[model samples]
Target: MPRGEKSAYTDKQKRQAEHIEESEREQGRSKEDAERIAWATVNKQDGGGKKSGSGRAKPH
Candidate 1:
């Protein structure tokens, strides 16, 4: 898939992912870990589809 392109996920899937992310954040993940999970599940790099936590980190 190209950058910015999207794949469909069920509403339940999305909600579940959001919950996971929120939980991770609440648990105090080093920003890097949080960004990775966001990208993996939501397809948004670094939480906003671009450099987050500086250019050193790549979304997972």
Candidate 2:
């Protein structure tokens, strides 16, 4: 559960991040910035990694 570790992310999420990163790079973002934006985007969409069993549900 280390910061910046992507092991908890699912394959689809990883692919989405990669695609987003590439798109960001195409739009003239730096490597680090693109990666940051990509992961942030994924986090916004998915609310973080889906592989973990705990904290996967939202309280009603």
**lDDT at residue 9 of model 1 (Cα atoms):** 51
Tens-digit per-residue lDDT, 1-60, candidate 1: 576343445455456567777778999986678656755865442243323245575435
The TM-score that candidate 2 achieves is 0.84
How far is 37's C-alpha from truth in model 1 (Å)? 2.6
Best by lDDT: 2
Runs with alpha carbons beyond 4 Å of true place in candidate 1 = 1-7, 30-32, 38-60
Cα displacement (Å) at residue 51, model 2: 5.1
- TM-scores of all models? 0.44, 0.84
Candidate 2 Cα deviation (angstroms), residue 15: 0.2
For model 2, the stretches where C-alpha displacement exceeds 4 angstroms are 51-60
